[model samples]
Target: MYESCFYFVINMSISGSLVILSLLIVRQIKIISRRLLYVLWFVALIRMLLPFAISSSISVFNYLSGLIKKLIPVGNLFDANFTVSNYFNAALSYSPMEYKTQRFEHVFGISSCIWLMGVCISLIAIIVIYCSTIRQYKNAVHLKDNIYEDKTVLSPFLLGIRNPKIILPIGLDISSSQAVHIIAHEKTHMQRMDNLWRIIGLGTVCIHWFNPIAWFGFFFFLNDMELSCDEATTKTYGFAKKKEYAEALFSIAGNRQNKNLIHASFGKSDTKSRVLNVLAYKRLSVFGIAASIAFLLLVAIMLLTNPKV
Candidate 1:
């Protein structure tokens, strides 16, 4: 029994440590250390799978050992005690009776310690980033109301903490050609509640501090969001407006200077991929839309399976 419990604790810790190691390797050595990450994945799998197999085998072995002891003619000198050794002896730490409870309590500690460490790291990151964003937002200036006469204009660091307001240079009138597309674009972002997702995503990462899959999942999620938004904006305005939108985007991107800690209002740094997705996008067929919805549902299932922190 003692040996089995020890095995389970070891197995669980290895499972957890490998998850953390995968993230650290990605951060530190980039692709050079990723092969080791694959090995870690295999190690994690074995650690998780072995316990049930080993427990079943050990239980059978223990039964056989007990049976063998019973079959023998026992004398004081020939005594064969097969009792599993209690890890805690009164001579060491606990009273003899306490060992029964202490073994399980010990295993539980391993999980608690791991979760605690993750929590600590997450809290510190959240606090730091939160403070930084607040500082930027406080320092931002409010510019005059923008009127789109169907022209696009490049603006600097436009942000609105409350209400609809564009923060750019004073006495500027964006061309009617560009203003129409730009207004539609920025307003769509505000309407979709994307700014809320930025906050929510950051908070979630804190809780899931140990999962590497979460990071990649979030990166692609954000990128796809931009691509999808671009698609919607372009499709609504029609293909004729693509050049105007693209040019506006390029101009803003060139002048875009975000606060050090705040998420960019326009899009992230993957402009090349965003440009490709925008240029390549074709109108979705009914079947294609249905298939895309089905894929989203499948991913939702995996997310639902995870126990929320």
Candidate 2:
């Protein structure tokens, strides 16, 4: 169990590096489609959850490993005679095997216990918060099909995984253009199944609670999700409707409350970034779309694969 925990920590460190690389790529490709940016973050999320990948010579990790070797002596980090593969294999075997040192074993056991404790606390906290939020909104008035009006919530958000309810706050004119845009935005989140994705992202963070980079990646992923949804909702709208969409977004942000991780709130994330993306929305040409797809594939190949052995 201790060996398994150590292996998990190593995998998470690799995934954190992937998150950093993805963030750099996102920064460079800010002009690309927001949906594509969301996809890039999704790739990072997959890395966080999965432990293995196919090795490739072109992988960014390959170069990074070389750079590290040049900057720091590998022998200083570990015993020159130590065999990593033998140690790892022995750790996995069920039969009793000789350990190099009792101190190492004791340290690993203690660390594993600490990691497990953190996981339990993080998971329990998330569940408690989610259940409390559900209880708070249990009596939400059903205004229409799959839509509810909750006086407590200050912004519109989608809740539930199987049967998501779009919750709107009180005093909003449903007939007005801003209301139309807000509803459309929530519907877009449902269409994209963003609530499910948000849950998965949060779960990943809970498991990797000790890693600050994982938390950063999770929040960035949420921001990207909102930006993509905004792009999708306003894709067909003209300048005036896009303006109205931005206005609706701004209104929601101003009155935003309930920034829960479990629910996909319309105005919960980086509102400044979302509003800017909405106002700068432009239809991509065929060539531009093709380029974006190619870029996505490139990112998948470069970052998703393991360093060549």
Candidate 3:
């Protein structure tokens, strides 16, 4: 009952946020590929798999086991029984009285060991990146109402956690550019709540906590998002104006002198891919979009409603 309730709350929080995000995507900003958004959603699922504690310390026991097995002298070395028993005791703080539980945990062999180690690594990476990203985000300055304010001009990232606002440097002004397509591009991120997507991707790192596939999924989703946003910008402006958009992309990217931790600047290292995808936009048939939508919905429904977990 408690688990059900907990899962329900998590589900509600996630769903509610997504609904708000989708509404913002529709009304406030434009997006190209909805399919890409779904891929990001997958990355997010991988991130939030388990809590921090269990995943965090999997590596300690793993290392201890390896160290003892490899480092102990042949005559003085503790054999498997002593080593595993000691590890269980140390990792779980088990008392000699709790022999049954200790035995069970100690008896856990290679497969569980490998899986747990993977989880710990994934969790650590996710956590480290998350904190770093937060610090970066907090550093960028937010601009108040100016003529540029109407254009949704986000500043380049600044440094550190405190007093971090998006920095609109002296010469590099996105809001003032002749190509208005850039505004739609960044606004699409805000409207779709790309920050939440980032959280999800990071969360997957925590969940899978060890899978390279999860990291790949995150990058793929991010790239797709950029591509989708590019498509939307093209649709809003026009395909023939690709060079203008490309030039604007170049300008925004070229001036990124500031390097902050992770506030997710408008144009980051993704500058090249974003420009390349804009030039590569191809019109999809009604059937393609429909099928992709169906796939995403089906996967989401199955994962969400399945009772077994």
Off by over 4 Å in 3: 1-104, 107-167, 255-261, 283-288, 298-309
Off by over 4 Å in 2: 66-100
Q: In terms of lDDT, which candidate is stronger, 2 or 3?
A: 2
Candidate 1: list runs displaced more than 4 Å.
1-121, 124-128, 139-141, 144-172, 175-180, 256-264, 285-287, 298-309
lDDT tens readout by residue for model 1, 63-105: 3332111111123543233122221221334345765677767
The C-alpha local distance difference test score for the whole of candidate 1 amounts to 0.44
Most lDDT-accurate candidate: 2
Q: How accurate locally is residue 34 in candidate 3, as Cα lDDT from 0 to 100?
A: 41
Ranking by lDDT: 2, 3, 1
Position 290, candidate 1: lDDT = 76
lDDT of each residue in 1-309, candidate 3, tens digit only = 433323333333333233323323432223335434645355235323421111122222233334221111113353321211111123343345666774664554443555556657866775687676554434334454221222223444222233333334434455555334555565555555565566555655444434454455555556565666667657645656887888777877765545322344556657887777777766667986787677555544433321210
Predicted candidate 2 versus true structure: per-residue lDDT over 143-235, tens digit per residue? 889888888889999887778888899777788888788889899999989988988888877777777888877777787788899999999
- lDDT (Cα) of model 2: 0.75
| Candidate 1 TM-score, C-alpha based | 0.52
Clashing pairs in 1: 149-176, 150-176, 150-177, 151-175, 151-176, 151-177, 151-178, 151-179, 152-178, 152-179
lDDT of 2 at 23: 69
